[model samples]
Target: MQKRAVSGVGLGLRSVHYDHVLSRRPAVPWFEVISENFMGPRGGSGGRPLEVLAKVRREYPVALHGVSLSIGSTDPLDFDYLKKLESLASVIEPWIVTDHLCWTGAHGKNLHDLLPLPYTEEAARHVAGRIEKVQDAIGRSIAIENVSSYLSYKHDEMAEWEFIARIVKTTGCGVLLDVNNIHVSAINHGFDGEEYLAGIPVAAVRQMHLAGYSEENGFLIDTHDHPVSDPVWKLYAAAVRRFGAVPTLIEWDEHIPSFARLQKEAAKAKEVQDGVCAAAV
Candidate 1:
């Protein structure tokens, strides 16, 4: 297994704060970037974004988080996309590479959304096989994150946590546990977030994601627009206790805030992490 290079808390690197981060060089341990944004024709090594990313990388570790891997789709694996992703990885050498467990498209059509998959034995085997192939293609293991869902399939034979656990056991891939996603999914589908946490194998989790969500018409949306909710912070505390200081990140994608605001939010995660570590001792 690859050693974890990132620790403590981190903030997602947004283009809005590129200048601030590059100029000031904040003390963030690492930054997670959307993989697709940097896969330019030149493999992103020569683009302006790549130049900025190179500067950030000189100061901090980076992780590649992707949204369009489509590992769960029935369509044939897109080797061309995988090749480009491999090239980007070669340049960046991210501490970790990851994508969502849900499928984003099907039948050569880009649906442009992280669609949920059926939680069944067959689905688990299929996704795990694809992940294995992806690892071989990239020449390294990758983490898979869970997506928040508003609906469930009637044919699901297992719980969401069970599905993820099975995938990890089968593929030997790490888990990027998204705390906000767990809370949103639990509330929307009527389950306990703590139960979900407990069901996951602690050793399989390599990283954790903390973000904010919004409520609309009684359903909680994974908006990542506001501050981390109090409830999600509590869940994060639980996760820290269970996982023992896994690399954590604060994700704020929409309504991008000032670099200072983002740093303040990251500071909160650091506070929680320090408190948890102290209590553990």
Candidate 2:
């Protein structure tokens, strides 16, 4: 299978590692940035954040990953947010743009967390229609990422993977399959991870994510603080096998580590990909 603009494994571009990335320009294949961070106050040149993003763009292909799209909210879409997002996309010209399939909040208030939705036919149609509008606004198809959930709604009608497959089928959008999230949710909700993998559409996956999690009371929390867990790494290998080496990213968000250590995590992902692809060949 042919990969997207970015191949191999990439790292999340956090502010802490700005100098190392700017000065050293490490061997990382690509970098993903939080879209809101560089959205830049409407009219300004985006000040320092935009400047740094410009510098990074010159060196590597950047993917704009967002946390605030709230694609599944019951409330109407936020035009202002879309305007800023569109402006950012214009400036960055990101290789890909993505946000969580879950909603953030409703009624004009922001909860600021990626909350899960009820997996129903109504939700499927609602979110798909919203995604089509979002695609029209952005002038491009954005990938929707599946989030790890600690709870489920009583009204859900299908599995999470089935819901995802429905969205992509309707909107023609891509999927950012987060392997670590599947590991976390499978443990929390007691579902078979392999079955979830088999349920998703293969060609819809445009990217994959691997991150660390914290376990408490036998429930896995999607905390990107620790290194990628052993089970998640195993799941990632399975994903590469099923998806044929799609562009994967190593995400470490909180309690950021040194650049060298971060690179080591990305390197480990690449090593796993190489092994999987080699064996398949």
TM-scores for all candidates: the values are 0.96, 0.97
Tell me the alpha-carbon RMSD of every candidate.
2.3, 2.4
Backbone clashes (count) for model 2: 0
Per-residue C-alpha lDDT of model 1 across residues 128-198, encoded as one tens digit per residue = 99999999999999999999998999999999999999999999999999999999999999999999999
Clashing residue pairs in all predictions, respectively, total: 0, 0
Give Cα distance to truth, residue 159, candidate 1, Å.
0.6
What is candidate 2's lDDT per residue for 107-190, written digit by digit as tens?
878899999999999999999999999999988999999999999988999999999999999999999999999999999999
Candidate achieving the largest lDDT: 2
Error of 2 at 3 (Å): 14
Worst 10 residues of 1 by lDDT: 39-48
Evaluated at residue 233, the lDDT of candidate 2 is: 91
